[model samples]
Target: MLIGLEIKNFAIVSNLSTEWHSGMTAITGETGAGKSIAIDALSLCLGERAEASAVRPGTDKAEVSAQFDLSNLPLAHAFLEENMLNNDDNECLLRRVVCKNGRSKSYINGSPVTAAQLKELGQYLISIHGQHAHQHLLKAEHQLQLLDAYAGHHNLVNAVSQRYKQFADLQKEFKQLEQQQQQQAAQKQLLEYQVAELDEFALQADEFEQIEAEHYKLSNSQTILQVCQRELQHLYENDEQNACSILQHSAQQFTELAQYDESLASVATLLSEAAVQVEEASREVRNYTEQADLDPQRLTEVENRLSGAMDLARKHHIKPQELVGFHQTIAQELESISNNSSRLEQLEGEIEHALEDYQNASEQLSASRHQYANTLNGLISESMANLSMENGVFEIALTAQNDRAPNSLGFDNVSFLVSTNPGQPLQPLAKVASGGELSRISLAIQVIIAQKVTTPTLIFDEVDVGISGPTAAAVGKLLRQLGKSTQVICVTHLPQVASSAHQQFFVAKEIADGETFTHMLALNKDGRVNEIARLLGGDNISKTAKANAKELIKAHG
Candidate 1:
């Protein structure tokens, strides 16, 4: 239930605060007096789209916040707890801010959140029926929604939707498999030939690099052997002027000097280490040179291997290093082509199973909807009779369409047909019902559906729009009854409707500081009488109007 609303600089409402209580609260005002502004503020708190124009001309931003009592609204509490936004107290605050630059922000329980979350919480806290809600009844899709809502078939609808999704997903997989089969079939011969060619090459990992290395070694064996011998001679075997011989002479000179200065001993050790290292290096180089002789037979074999790799790589439009990967890919493609028929059959079988599941769920859903259609028609017709249309005939016509492809909502088409006169034949609401009758039907449907709604509050923006007389009284009483189980707030102009509110708020416009402003005040009993009397008598309230207002109030009480 909504406990409070605070709005600042929103349109003409500059810093308005109001406390709400349980039960029906009627908001009354003259035209252009900002009754709808209050509803708009509530909608802003409920995550409606905000525009820069919503801010007053002199203000930089507009803010609207609503407080809800969560003590009895279990669904709201669950939502808050699930989101970790629940506070210690059994109350939640929803806040919205709209900047003059057309930016908007939303909050729940002082925690910043997205507009979608606010909308989600708003679903559990408030349901609004605006002045144009009657036109919604003209749409068959909306009628179907209304029927399902009234029948409390939310779970069934969800089940059917889930089944449809399963079927759709399976069908998508089947189509993709079929397409893959067709594509692969067209390319199968080419792929098989490629695989055979690659297999004939018989490429192995690391063979290309190893063979190249061997080819390099065999092709340059004589040069390598000579270089090795030259290195060995330069290091140690060259006469007198080689690096090892020069180092030995320097070591001798340094050793003699160190002998004279006591550092000569360390230099002597260095000369000994240099001679030993040179000898070992010379032996290793000689060993390699002796083993470096070429074999023409092995050389020819390596050249043949490299030539084969290059030719095959060129033929396949790839480098020699990529041959292994190309071979693997072709092999996998051949395997898949071999298994494509079996895979398609597998997908088809799964699709058939999914189709069966979807058909079962949809058929059950259709049967349930058809069964509830009669009950809903009877309830709506009776509700219309209570609203003073004693001859109203309502029918929920369900057409099972076999040729129509199953959609997310199932295979049945639902249309609402109505007749407002005794001898009239039932026709579509758009073709048959007058504006007043539409309003009544809309109201009757709302009243019937409200019983099944778990939301704790509902707002009606002058549901009595095209209604008056006894019918208006009946609408007001129906709202009051709805308020018995849910918090009801109605913005209305009719005294008959306003009189039925447990609480009343009178809205009026004021010209302050040369700017238009809107203000709302909670009306006490005396104030309620005066407001209702004003609604009855306009600017001139007579004793009879006051008396009639008092009688209407007393009767509603």
Candidate 2:
């Protein structure tokens, strides 16, 4: 419940602080007394838009702060906990500051927050009915929403939404795939030709390297043979002074010397090893010199193959090494085209399944709505009669536009119908209900749905406008009754309503220091009497009006 409100430099309210009780708090003042100004200040805490003009003429900024005792507002508490916004006190503070520059900031529990967060948290703490709130009930969309809330069918509605979303997603995917398939079908022949060319090459990872190595040997064979010939002539073909003959002769001399001296024995072993290596090297060189032959045909074949692969890579805008990955990509595209018909068949079946799920959920929701609609109509009709519409008839007409495409809310179109007079035929509430009648209707519906509203505080801004006499009294009584379960706040001009408040505040303008200001004062019994009497007899207080005010308070008390 809202515990208090403080306003500073806001509009005509230079500064005002007012405490509120649990039950109905009726706010009353003379016309232009800034009655709604209080509500406007509260609106800021509720995340309503602010303007620079809201600031007092000489002030730099305007501020509005609200306090709530969340001991009973579990929904609000849970929201705070879930969002990690709670301050651990079970008491929440919301503040809004609007600057003359049109910039605004909000704070929750003294922590900085965005305006949107305030609004989200506000939904669970306070529900303020603007003066024109009743006008909304006439719309079909609003009607459906209210009906759903009253029915407590949120889970069922969510199921329908989930199913509808699935169907929509599947339909979207199918369309995209089908469009792509049609595009690919046009390129089918091109893809087939490309794949055939690649298949002929039949690329092997190791084959490229091997072919290049063999090609190098064939291409440079002439140069290799000349170098080998030079080496062999110097080492073995030098007439009688060849390397083999010298090493052999040297080794035999060392062996003969080693027989005469011990130090020559080591030198003899070294020369013998040198003679064997020289002879082997001479034999291999002669063999290579004999077999060195260039083959142009093999080299040409390898060069053509490499050039072809390079040209393909260039056409694909890729490096020669990237051909493998590109080949795999093209293969997949070809496979997709081949398997497309079966894929389309699979998508069609999946779409059907999604549609079936949505249909089942929507049907279930519709059934529940129909059952609850009758009971809701009967209750509102009774409330309407109690609020002075003697022959009022309230009905919820559910029409199924079944052939319409699937939607998140289902296939039903809800309309609120009303017949304010006996001879009148039931018609759309928007067309038939007068402004006063709409107010009454709105009040009746709100009262009926109060139990379903999770918000702990309900505020009505002159909801009794265009109503008087017994009807005003009944509206007050109903509001007071609602206040018993949840905190109710109403701004009213009627003495009947003001007299019924468990707590009453009078808004009045005062002048001091050459500046005008609006202020609120909580009314005691005598203050209530004077205020009620003033409401009855204008600025003049009369004895009869005072007596009437007393009787009104007595009856309610």
Candidate 3:
């Protein structure tokens, strides 16, 4: 519950601190007594948006802080634990500061938090039902949500939502697969022809390089052969001056000298070995010269084979060595095309199974919602009658949509209809009720669902508007009953409603030294009577009105 609130430089509230108690508390004063300003300050602590205009004159900033005792609220503790913002003291403090430059900051448990985090925590702590709450009742979506909450179908709704998301994902994947198959089919015949043509060539991995080398050798064969012939003629082709004849004469001279000295014998042996090696080399050169061939046809064939390989490489944007890998890839693609029909059939089977699962989940969800809708219509009809709508008819109209499966909520579209008079046709809630009637309807629904709501604090901002006499009394009684389980703070103008409060506060505007400010004071027993008397008689508090206020309090007591 909201235990305390502090405000400074916020609107006409320069400085104020208000302490709240359990059960129903009423804030009452004359019109424009800064009653709404107090609520606005509380709103700031509840994570409502703030602006510089909310700051009082001559102040650079405005601040609002609220303290909540979170010892009993497990949800709040869980949220704090999830955010790593847990406090050891079992209390939570929320503060907001708005600067004159239009900047605002929020803090929880003395740690700075983003505005979104503050709002999330605020939702779990307090529920403020203002004049605008009546507007929400006019929306069929809100009504549907309230009914779902009462029926306790949150888990069922989540199950349906999960299945819907799965179905959508599978549908997307199927479409992408179909598109890929279509594109692959269009290129099927072309890829087959290319693969067959490349296979027919029977290209080897190193064949291209070998053919280029052979082509170069054949092109220079004549020059190489002429050079070899000249060298062989100098070494062995000349008569008497040839290398073999010269080496033979040198060996004969060395053999004659070897008889005169021992050193000459070793020199004669080396000359003989050299002569043998030179003669062998001369014979091998003569044999190579005779066998050399310069065939133009073989050279042309080698050149044509190399050119074809190079052209294929360039056309495929690959190196000559990569032709083998290209051929392998084409073969794999051809195989895949041959087996596409089987693969497509498998995908179709999977899709059908997924659709069947989704339909089962959707049908179950729709049936549950139909049951929930009937109960919801009955509950609202009962609540409206209790709120003094004698001839009002409340209903939930469920319309089925085609093909589209259930969503997170259900497949049925729910709309709330109501008739204010017996003979009138039932229409949408927004078109049927006046502002005052809408407020009572909202209060009835809130009272009916208050047991299901887990919020620690519930604030009703003049929900008693446009009610009087016994109806006002009944509204006050209902609020008192709601306060038995939750902390309820009501801002009301009716004396009967104010008199029903377990605690009462008065908001009054004061002008001190030419400065206007607002103050809130918790009223005691006598003070409560005086405030109630004021509300009873307006600006004039008479002795007779005070007596009437006392009688009203006595009657309720």
Could you tell me which 10 consecutive residues in candidate 3 have the lowest summed lDDT? Answer: 402-411
What clash count does candidate 2 reach? 0
lDDT of 2 by residue, 366-401 (tens): 999999899999999998998999899999999887
Q: Is candidate 2 or candidate 3 better by lDDT?
A: 2
TM-score of candidate 2 against the unseen true structure: 0.90
Instruction: Rank candidates by lDDT, best first.
Output: 1, 2, 3
| TM-scores vs. true structure, each candidate | 0.82, 0.90, 0.81
Instruction: Give the CA lDDT, 0 to 100, for residue 131 in model 3.
Output: 62
Pitting candidate 1 against candidate 2, the one with the higher lDDT is 1
The order of the candidates by TM-score, greatest first, is: 2, 1, 3
> In angstroms, what RMSD does candidate 1 have relative to the true structure?
6.9
lDDT of each: 0.88, 0.87, 0.81
Off by over 4 Å in 1: 180-188, 206-307, 336-341
The number of the candidate with the highest TM-score is 2
